[model samples]
Target: MDDQTLRRAVNATLMPGFQGPDLPAWLAAELAEGLGSVCLFSTNIVDGDQLRSLTDAIHATNPAALVATDEEGGDVTRLHHRAGSPYPSMAFLGHLDDEAVTEQVGWGIGNGLRAAGIDLNLAPVADVNSNPRNPVIGVRSFGADAGLVGRHVAAYTRGLQAAGAAACAKHFPGHGDTATDSHLALPTIGVDAATLAGRELAPFRAAVDAGTLAVMTSHILVPAIDPDLPATLSAPVLSLLRGQLGFAGAIVSDALDMAGASGGGRGIPEAAVMALAAGCDLLCIGTDNTAGQLAGIREHVLAAVRDGRLPEDRLLDAAARVGDLARAVAALPRNDRSPGSHVPDPRAESRPEGTPHLSPAGFWLGDPVHPLTAPVFLRLSSTANIAAGDTAWGVADHLAGELADRLPGSTCVDAADLTELAGVLDAAAGRPLVVQGRDLARVPFLVDATAMVLQRRPDALVVELGWPELPGAIGIATYGSGRGAATCLIRLLAEGSR
Candidate 1:
């Protein structure tokens, strides 16, 4: 291949994220040179108008370039990262077992993305959360049951694509059963072949059958398939997706900067080559990518192709696949309107006049607890997972702000031990206590603290902002910490009092 052909092929497979809300000079030049895609992170976004302008600038530079973001609509939202998403999570939809509602949520998210000028959404986590302790995929997954996850994955894919934005079913071969976060380190899926086929592969198959335009690869090792390489760098795993699942769409690699892919002394550029050779059609270089890093990756890929380490044919195939997806996305109907302008108001559905509008964000565990009167919000905090980052979340703050007059005192504490729990409870000062937490079931200390609080103050209301598994607590599980869940929980509390 000549230098121009090689450069174009290399650029087509590279999807890098840049700093700031504006398109940088380097990135604009890259886009004009046939860079197939660019990923937008929270840093690149400010508001709908800013996002639209940025994406419009990208498209203006290269009309064929695809713009993508991780807008999974729940905890992993990009468009609404600052305030949290206004939509229910997959787990909430799965708990309701309503496919129509799930589709509507997908459509709403897609419309939001479409309005933002984004072409692709790397979302609809197809991983079945079989392991409750999964640090990365907890509430992101639909459910623990493979069938339920598959059903919702298909529904979400159909809805997202139907709304003019391409949906990419993610973390292929499943990242649900592992306890480790791939962002920090590599996790090995220890399940056998049959177990893998029965549990993990089901959702990917469903996604393919649903006409998903892209499938994102996970960075975990499946000893059942190949003991050495992670799925992002395993041809056998990619073949399994292509042959058995019959997925002809693009295979997107998780961020190469992740420790799971770049750890053990391998750099992002090398990982990009390995992922492409392993059958990934597009390589996500990582967030806040610099021009120097992009140049390094391009040089590494070109060298690999010239040295015959990565075949020219393989590079061409990957680039062609990316180009095809970009063309398909370009052909989708454009929604130039402002975000959420055309999407139906999910909360506007008919309800009895004067009754509280209970959105899908609220999932009642036990009976409705005693209503809030002079409530004191006590937050039991946990370490934020790397995937969710340090985004603003939780219902306590939102509720406190909304019901400031009713709230006497509100404090957030790490209730890691009995002493901390005692302090937290004491801070409530015998007022009607409302304990707020996220993924309480995953952390032993939070569970123990919550249980002790409930035992001491059985009248206390427990609100779980993450996946709800707090047994014996008469609480509301919002299934997410997004603004939607917070609003729903507040309405439920207000309604109960009335």
Candidate 2:
């Protein structure tokens, strides 16, 4: 192949992320040279206007280049990272079991992305959260039921695509049954073929039937299909998605920088080559990627083609698929919704009228009781998983101005700081105490601390901001820590105080 033909083919298969909010000079140059796509993270976003400008800049350099973001609209959000996401999580929607509401939420997320000039959204996680102890995909998933998750995935895909943003159902085959986080390690799904098809692959099949524009591969090992390689590097697995699933959309690989993909003595460049050979049309090369890294991956991909390890025809086919996706997205009617219009705080107007009265925000475990006359807020802090990162969560910051003096504000206590729990309990001596936490069931220390506090202040109300797995506690589970969930909890608390 000629040098220019080889360069364009290699560039079209890469979807890389770069540093900062503004477009870096090197990335701009690459876009002009035929880089097919770029993925955005929280660091590259400030607010809606800046994000729109960034995407516009990307398109200006290369109109065919796709702009993608992980705007899952719940726990894993990039557009609304500063303030939490305005839409309820997939778990909360599943708990409600209302397909219309789920579709509306999906449309809202896609509308926001479309207004921001983003083409693709890596979202609508199709995994069934079969394992409650799963660390990565708890609230991110719709639920444990295969049928429920599959239907919701289909609804979300339809809604998102209708709003002009392409939806990419992710972590293919399944990533919900494993205990390990794929970002940190490679998780193996040991289930048999029947279980895998009935439970894991069911939602992906639904997504394909729903005409989803793309599907993202996971860095997981399914012993039933391919024992040696993860799905991103396994031809048998990708072929299952392509042949059995009858999906003609672009196939995207999960970020190659994850330990699950690049670990075991292999670097990202080799992994990129392997992923393309495995049938991934577009490779996401992780977050905060540098110019040198992109160049190195391109070189390695080129070298692989020259060495006959990766066929030139295969490379061209992948690039063609990516081009087709971009062209499809470009052909859609322009979304004229004003930028930043869909991101309003959803506490008041967003909820559908006559909805189930399981409290306005979340369901209550017990009878409605206001045990607090004088209240002290205690926020239990724990290590956020790698996927959620260190983005601020909860309503502490939002409630500071309103309840500054009377409530004495919220005290943040680390999960490991067991000694401080006593002092916190002591501080709320003659008052009713309210505690907040995220995924309390997942953290042993947080669970023990919550139990210890409940022992002392039995009337205390627990507010769970993560997944709603905290049993035996008189609390409200918001199902997520996003802006919508936080606002609902805050309103509930305010009503009780009044």
Candidate 3:
């Protein structure tokens, strides 16, 4: 790839797009000419072998192309396999509040992607989800606190990079505060730059300072900073991001097909060209563009360059940055491999073996096969009835007061001091424990750790507060807090005694 070729490749790379199964004939043509990268959606992933074959095909045509996806765990996982990777959500990781757990998840996810031969992971969402009602960023962000989310974001970036995958922190200038969805229409955040710097930008700054390889711009409008152009097409926003924040990594635009960018009445390719000229080095076509739409985007770029409407240098620079990103990603070492590769685990806890029934709650200090194990919380809250020692008691005070009255001998646990539970579980000889919370799967090891203790005792009962989709030794889903869970548990316990 010489400079001229690389330049065209970069421009093509910036014109990122996705296509469905038919793989439009023009797709091959675009690849041959250097259209940068293609993002994979759920539709693109048929099976592991098929996915690997697709990547091989892409590389065969354009060796420098960067294949990317929204492999962010939870609501936004792209490469889900019934058998391959343990698909958990960001909410699960966020609930556990354990960096080590989050880091392992990143490694697992990153490793799984590398095994599939994908290069870029547009993940570790850096949005500071301050708006609880925020339709888009719910559970996608690490948490509400800027510093906390920042720490996890940095950890995710480091872990992904460590596992030989490039991590992209996204929705620059923060999309978390908006009330509307950017997919349908442009969302405007009237926040001033200082307030944004304090709340929204902190996590991104942390990611940038940690040497993240990519930072994606949002499609939302920030009147305080760049009212004329959304962050995706605003030089001022880019200046703030690059000049003030000193982010030298590749600057990516959120999907050009998104209503926020396209709403201003520009066609897809026009948006792509504008994004590049506005300082975005990569143009994401998002995932929903039709085949005809994708081809149109390509033709638009080609026409722009041919007619001198879009300077060839702009496209070249964007592609250069993309190529540089590809080099950086390709240079990293690979993760070992995913456990089940492609076959879904029939015995996976999410899919149990028997009739839906509850198990007796007993603690096993150690082991997986033991019958009497302590109860595990699928979504643990202090409001439940699980006995806790005096020192560990009252932890649930942070959860809710209504839940506090139901558990006679149970105690509450705060999110911050959960490590104490690990220590308590370690020292217990064998006791019936009931863990709470619907987010157990997020912390794969914690679930394993809790189950390891249960194996030492097999009489463990797992209590789930949300959906009863996951499996457990003895599974119970009371659905919600309060009397429903309390009444069900009391009846189950009374029946067990009989």
Q: Could you tally the backbone clashes for each prediction? A: 0, 0, 53
Write down the TM-score of every candidate.
0.91, 0.92, 0.67
Lowest lDDT 10-residue stretch of candidate 3: 385-394
Off by over 4 Å in 3: 1-11, 15-24, 81-85, 288-295, 302-312, 335-498
Better of 2 and 3 by lDDT: 2
Clashes of 1: 0
lDDT of 1 by residue, 95-154 (tens): 877777777677777877887899899989999888878888988889999999999999
Q: Cα deviation in Å at residue 157, candidate 2?
A: 1.3
Candidate 2, 170-282: lDDT as tens digits: 89989989999999999999999899989999999999998899999999999899999999999999998999899998999999999999998899999999999999999
RMSD of each: 3.9, 3.6, 13.8
Question: TM-score rank, highest first?
Answer: 2, 1, 3
Shift in Å, residue 451, candidate 1 = 4.5
Which should have the higher lDDT, number 1 or number 3? 1
Model 2 regions lying over 4 Å from their true place: 333-364, 369-374, 401-416, 496-498
Q: Candidate 1: deviation at residue 26, Å?
A: 1.5
